[model samples]
Each structure stands twice: as C-alpha cells, then as structure tokens.
Target: MSEVPLPSLEVDVPPEGLSIGETARATGLSVDTLRYYERAGLLLDPAPRDGGGRRRYGSADLAWIAGLVMLRETGMGIGDVRRMAELSRTAGTEASRLAVLEQHRERVLADLARTRAHLAALDAKISSYRHAVAEKENA
Candidate 1:
C-alpha cells in the first residue's frame, strides 16, 4: 500500500492577537463562555484589552483556554478546574496538582466503567426483545 501525506493545517495569527470573539470562533466556544472563563479567573490574569476595552487573547492565552475546555469537557466540575488553575499559579505545587488530577481521573475511569457495563446490559435486553418479536412474527 502507498502512503499518503496529510494536508497542512496551519493557522494564521495576526500580530495584534485575536479578539475575544475571534478566539471563541477558533476554539468552538461561545463568546459568553469566554468572558465567563476570564471573569471567573479560570484562565490567566486579565487578558490584554484594547484601548476600547475589548479583550485581545494571545496565542498562549488561547492555548491555556483550550486546555481548560478539555478539562471541562471531560466532566470536571468548575470548582476542580479552578483549584487546578490555582495550583498551577504558585511555585512548587506539583504534588497538589498531581493529587487533584489523580482524583478526577479515578472518578472518570469509574464512570466510564459503569457506562460500559450499563451499555452491555441494555444491548442484551434489546437483543432479547428483538428475538422475542421475531419469534412472534414467525408463529
């Protein structure tokens, strides 16, 4: 088999940095969510704002926001996210960060296991109903 090269996926960033709305569009988050995150201090310190008071998110800010989005998407609560963000700010908080993430990871793994088990049970029930219906039709 021949190998195929993937197409380029580079993004062009402006020198002045992207506005909050532009960052939201690129990150698939709503403008309100971006503002909420910033207001909650879930991300870094006050983002650079334009003279007119519009937020101008830089590349690093966008990257950090992306990580926060990932954590939220993975079922982490806002409190936990905030704690992790806090831990990340100070010096020598590695152990605390590890502890926080480990606890969340355990919970997520347990939930995943329960979901799989429930799915299997549902599948079995569905299969039984299908068989019963097929038998009735044949009769």
Candidate 2:
C-alpha cells in the first residue's frame, strides 16, 4: 500500500496572528487543550490577548505549543514538560534540557529495539506457517 502523507504541523506566520480557533486548527489541538495550557502554565506565558481581549496566538506561541504536544505525545509526563518549560524560562539551563531529552531518547530507542525484535519473531513464525501450508498443498 502507498503511504498517505500526514498533514504538516508546521505553523506559518500569520501577520495578524492567529485566534484560538485558528491556532487549534494549525496545531491539530482542541481549543480546550489550548485553554488548559494557559491554566496549567505549560507555555512560555498565557498567550497574549488581542485588541478585543480575545486570545491571539503568535507564530512563536504556536511553535512552542506544537513542541509541547510532541513531548507529551512522545510519552513525557505533564510534570516533566512543566519542568522543561521552567528550564526554558531561565538562563543556563541548556544542559538540564539536554539531559532530559537524552534520557527520553534512550527510552525511545530501547522501545524501538524491543518492537523490532518482536516483529522479527512474528515474521519468522509467519514464514514457517507459509512453508508448512505450501508443503501440505504439494502433498
């Protein structure tokens, strides 16, 4: 089967900035999630408001939120993401951030190796079954 391309999560700069709904669409997150980020302090700061006092999301904000989504979806706990956000807010925290990410990367690579091993075992079993079926057909 041909692989279907997934939509890009990359946020383009909107000169006027994006409204909450537009930000949700661009990031594939719900408005509720965006609001939760505000309440949870997961972002750099609560997204700034526009002239009318509605939340206006800048491109930078969208990019940051997308990263948060990636981290959380990649099995990072909310608390860890919060810690990383705090680190980002301070200066000279690069090494801490790298350590956190390096740890997560190691976990991911280990999981990948385990999954590949399982897949190989399953493939071998499937080949054995196919050969058995072929022999029965010949008989």
Candidate 3:
C-alpha cells in the first residue's frame, strides 16, 4: 500500500490570531467544541483575546488542538489527554511525556491487534456465508 504523508507542520504557524469563529471555520470544528476542549483541559495554553477581549487562537494553538483531536481519534481518554497537556506545560523535561506516550502506544498496539483478529474472524464468517449461499443457489 502507498504510504500517506503525515500532515505538514505549516499549520503550526498562525500569523494573526483568529477569533473563535474564525478558528472554527479554519479547523472545521465547532465553536462549542473548541470551548468544550478548553473546559476539558485539553488545550495547552489559554487562548488569547482580541482588543475587545474575545478569545483568539493562533497557529500554535491550532496545532496543539489538532494533536488533541488525533489523540481523541486514537481512543485516548480525556483525563489521560489532560494529564499529557499538564506534562506539556513543563517544556524542559520529556521523561514524563515519553512515559505517557509509551503507555498509550502500548494500548493502541494491543487494540489494533485485537481489531485485526476480529476482522479476520469476520472475514471467515463472510466466506462461510458466501459458500452457503452458493450451495443454496445451486440446489
């Protein structure tokens, strides 16, 4: 199978901070979900504010949120993701970060193995069904 390239880091640079509405439009996420992520402690830094004090998100903020979205898609728990975010706040050391990632990686590997096994079983069942259907049609 052809390898799919990972998303580029270019999204990491947001020049002019975007309002919540603009960010929602850019990321294809809802404003309510953005607020929910903030409330859930999934965001690394507090979103900045415009002159009028409305929440504004920059490229770095979007990058971090995209990472959170990836973790969620991978079936990571919100609480664990929050813990990872807390670890990220201390940028110097990466031991804690590595530990968290290693643990999650193990979990993901195990889940993937199980999913593949289930898929194999389903394929076998499907083959059996097809054989039975063929026999019925021949009769």
Per-model TM values vs. the true structure: 0.85, 0.79, 0.85
Q: Which stretches of candidate 1 lie over 4 Å from their true place?
A: 1-11
Give all candidates' CA lDDT scores: 0.80, 0.82, 0.80
lDDT of 3 by residue, 22-129 (tens): 777767789999999898878988898778889988777877877887778888898889998898887654778778879999999999999999999999999999
Which residue pairs does candidate 1 place in steric collision?
none
Per-residue lDDT over 67-99 for candidate 1, one digit per residue giving the tens place of the 0 to 100 score = 788788879999998898898787688789789
* Deviation from native of the Cα of residue 19 in model 2, angstroms: 1.1
Which is the winner by TM-score between candidate 1 and candidate 2? 1
Error of 1 at 67 (Å): 0.8
Alpha-carbon shift of residue 78 in model 1 (angstroms): 0.6
Who wins the lDDT comparison? Answer: 2
Off by over 4 Å in 2: 1-9, 132-139
Backbone clash numbers for all candidates listed? 0, 0, 1
**Which regions of candidate 3 deviate over 4 angstroms?**
1-14
Give candidate 1's whole-model lDDT. Answer: 0.80
